[model samples]
Target: MNKDYFKLTGEKINIEDLSREIVSDSKDEEIKKELYDELVPKLRELHAKLFAEAKYGILVVLQAIDAAGKDEIIKYIFSNLTPQGLKNTSFGKPTEEEESHDYLWRINKGLPKRGEIAILNRSYYEDIISPKIYDTLDSLPDEIKNDPELWNKRYKQLNNFEEYLDENGFKVVKFYFHVSKDEQRKRLLERIEDSTKNHEFSFSDLEDRDNWDKYQKAFEEMLNNTSTEIAPWYVLPADNPWYSRKVATLALIDVIKKINPKFPEFSAEDKEKAEKIAEQLKNKEI
Candidate 1:
């Protein structure tokens, strides 16, 4: 995947200008499969190295509309990672404690420790997008709720927070799964009709779908305002599950490769002790 086509770092993004289906230049399914097959093992290897190095952390934030395939993409691409090194958190409706805190408080608590990879299925961005569309700002403080510049202020806060993470050795990668309205409807219907997926369907999903245009505007503003050099957003064409998975996988691998985590170097004393222990093992000493 050409990362630039999907990346929105320091660029104004118009969701209308982006395709929700596979781009014309996207690779065929065969090529996508081949690339995916190659990338997964490489990602696993990098993730292991990252865990051992304990020098950097990775935070992957996934945001999408209903039935945009966030769950599927995360499962397929990241489930291969070692449980010890990877943490996946899905943010749904906030709990009482969470609701009492600032929107990013739960998100902060979920951030990865050094040398770990944290995947957020839905994140603080939801605060901006969903609430903006639904006008569900009653829970917020009056200053934030009533401020005309609330969205802009929130964007600045997010940018500063992400920059702080970056400066503190956490690399942030965000994905916006861009599924078409028709595709989303198709998937939502499948959820209702497919027995195995019935549990995933809810009346609220349909209600949210009714505000699709509003959500799109909110998403576009979110992407344009918050995509920065430290934490860029990738808008994946999500109509084709296979293609989106491949793109997401490739994007992650690209970031990890850039991070270039490695096994920690041993100190002189540690190396001497390791050699002694190695010699003892070679001699079959208990």
Candidate 2:
């Protein structure tokens, strides 16, 4: 994957300028084969090393508009991971208790331990994006709604929090699935029309779709403001699940390789004791 096609870091993004799908279905088959045969195994192997080392953590944030393949990523990629060191968390509207704390408080509590991987489905960014779309504030002073700089301040706070995590040996990998309005409409309609998928439809999805432009602007602003060197965001063209998954798997493998976790070494005394034990067992064989 040529990361420049999707990687956003301090560069302003126009949501309309990105591709919704880049590869043909024929090519997608080859990419799918490579992912299952090559990349996924490598990811599993690297995760083992990371778990053994107990040194660093990986925090993967999956942010997207409705029906943009977030669940598929979790099902195909994350489900293949070792459950011993992996956690998947999804955030929705905050509870009253959550509202009492600072916006990032619940997020901080959900962070993975060293040598673990955490997948946050919809994250603290919801505090910024949904409220902007719906005009709902949870217990905040009324003036905050009118403050033009509030968005910037929230972005800075998130950036700083991510930088702190980076410094503390955790790498935050963010993926924003950029499904176009037309594709979204198709997916939403499928949810309504297909009996098997009827469970997926929600009236709120339609309301949100009605404010599609506002959501796009909000996402673009977020991409420009919060993508940093330590915690960059990758925008995936998600109209085709194959293309997005291929790119997502590649990006994940790249980061794990960069993390480069290794198994711990044994001390000289322990090695000697193991050799002695082996010798004793060899001599005492029945």
Q: Between which residue pairs do clashes occur in model 1?
A: none
Deviation in Å, model 1, residue 91 alpha carbon = 1.1
TM-score list, all predictions: 0.93, 0.93
Which pairs clash in the backbone of model 2? none
Q: In model 2, which regions exceed 4 Å deviation?
A: 143-145, 277-286
Model 2, position 18, has a per-residue lDDT of 80
For 149-219, candidate 2 gives per-residue lDDT tens digits of: 88888998999989999999999999999998889989999999999999978888888889989999999
lDDT of 2: 0.87
